[model samples]
Target: MKPLVILLAAAAAFGADPPAREKLPTSRADLENGEKLYQANCGLCHGTKGDGGRGAVLAGRKLSRAADDAALVKVIEEGVRGTEMPGAWQLSARESRQVAAFVRSLSRVSSKPVPGDPSRGAELYARNHCSACHTIRGLGGSAGPDLSDTGLRRNPAFLRTSLTDPEAELPRSYQLVSIRSNSGSTITGARLSEDSFSIQVGDSSGKVHSFWKHEISELKKERGKSAMPSYKQLSSADLDDLVAYLSSLKEAS
Candidate 1:
């Protein structure tokens, strides 16, 4: 049978929703074929190992898009709207499934359920001013990552560690920066973008500041650091509640 026919047949089998279990290519030849397809199609953005560069990291991490085999297949076939991700309609449905399985084989996040009351954690999240930096469902500041999908993107253990020691796996993108203008004014904020000539920053107050390098007397890039403070000072129960709350935030499908 032709590849396009195979693709259409598979799509018809699943209909609107994905099947319960994703059928991955099992044989060595099949796996190799998937890898070749992945390299040709996905490697430019997702990286060969899916460690991420221009795209979100996929290696050893949980994916925000449907993580299951079937869901992954659907996401690959249909794509997410209003995002850089695009549907791979050029590929056959069987190829889409194959690539999804290969992507799944790259990483797996912990399935451990978060502990504590999510409602109580919600209170704690607000009390601790988590929204001062992070955004949830577009209701908070943008200094930190949007918590709308942290649960799907990060595992429980990673969330706990983030609160306890923020520097552990801080991405370079989130590094803090301080720039002193020639007029004795200082702007401390998270770097939004930077180039040799100019830099953009989002301050704690959710204000953006853009400055040319020549206008600034001093510019400091604080590496291996985050504007977010560690939560080790919080009481044990409060800490757990915060982690529980953060870990419970999964983007609605």
Candidate 2:
């Protein structure tokens, strides 16, 4: 048999090269290498300490999408299909598993205590009509990203930045989009979905508008923008309390 054929046969007999999963690396050297790898590739978005920034937080709270070690490895290697997270195609299977193990260990790192009163923050949330756009538990609007696990997915610092400067890290999925039909009608709302041929938008009134590409005379996505206004006007105490309240939301189910 040809050498290449022999190699393929050997790989099949054992396992695929760079297999989908790797055993969780728990050794000190492996974890150290994993930390270095994570810092280089993931720290920019997930934060140097996994406190979270452009990406979801990795520490203290449960990771919804990458729920387990194997799942985390898959996410790192293949990426989440639709979201901003791209695959770490550069990492080998062994390296990916090491990274996964490091990520799992981050949850045990003690997070700084959230200062302020959660009860007061809850009141502030209602007073500001936050639920009109965001959701908590099983209630509220779908226009914005679900906050059922924001506390877990994001740290208090991230929550504060989101409140103060929403445009800084406007989630691409929830950016405000405008669509104008050939009929001279315009609809500006949250973009529900987009595809090669059709686009869907949801107005503030929760009305969904669908249009074909041919029917759309003008379609513009407002990048680096958010429909949610900034809450920077809130007093320092209020901000602290609100951060506390948002950081308290850990329920993802």
Candidate 3:
């Protein structure tokens, strides 16, 4: 055989490079490097601790767009279309992979599994008339926050806190409002939106009441109050069942 042919045969017998998957470095150092990159590049919008600010919450929440490491790497390298999230142009391929690993580290897998029958919880949810104010998959009233994706956004502990103490953490949108009109009629509801001149409220009856600043005699916006009452009165098993049912709710399901 020719010398060139022998060389070709030898080259074919052994690979020149390792497989692509083998090149991926998963070490403590890599994760630390990724954290530095994430803090420098993404922390401003995603919050220093990844709790969220101008951008969506990253920690302890379900990430629909990039559910896995590979997908996250792609998203970090190439931004999501039609969204404010921009691609990381400054990062190299390795740096992008590092960032994805760091992001995956933020996922909080629940130690205690959801501890009730979802089917029974659904029955209890209906029995409790929860649909009167809150919405579940667009089937309930619009007065309260839509809980179609509650399972995705909130953890089990947070859900439990919300159920036991409804007023513990009040988002600006859900702050309780009491408006007394010129006719002495009082309307209490959760504030939906507000501006300098007008405020929109969704009352207990699922009716939106829009009032101009000049029209209402008194406008009371009380923080740490929710239209939804506490469910501490319910039996422990019932509450657990309800929570389980709620926890089962996801945007996809």
Task: Write one digit per residue (lDDT tens) for candidate 2, span 1-253.
Answer: 6999999899897875665544698999999999999999988889888887767788876778876677888898998777678899999888888888899899788667889999999999999988876778878876677888788667777789899988877677877988889999999888878899999887765566789999999999887777777999999999999999998887865
Q: Write the per-residue lDDT of candidate 1 for residues 88-192, one digit (tens) a residue.
A: 999998888778777877775323455777789899888888888888998988777777877655555567778888887775677799999999999988897
List where candidate 3 sits over 4 angstroms from the true fold.
1-25, 32-62, 67-99, 105-112
Using TM-score as the measure, the top candidate is: 2
Error of 2 at 172 (Å): 1.3
Query: Which scores higher on lDDT, 2 or 3?
Result: 2
Candidates 1 and 3 compared by lDDT, better number: 3
lDDT of candidates 1 onward, in order: 0.77, 0.84, 0.77
What digit string (tens of lDDT, one per residue) describes model 3 on residues 137-204? 77877778887867654555567777888877555567888999888899999888889999888887
Worst 10-residue stretch by lDDT in candidate 1?
A: 105-114
Which runs in model 1 stand beyond 4 Å of their true positions? 1-23, 27-110
At residue 79, candidate 1 shows an lDDT of: 77
Scored by lDDT, model 2 comes in at 0.84
Q: What TM-score, over all chains together, does every model reach?
A: 0.62, 0.78, 0.67
lDDT of model 3, residue 134: 81
Error of 1 at 124 (Å): 0.8
Distance (Å) between predicted and true CA of 193, model 3?
1.2
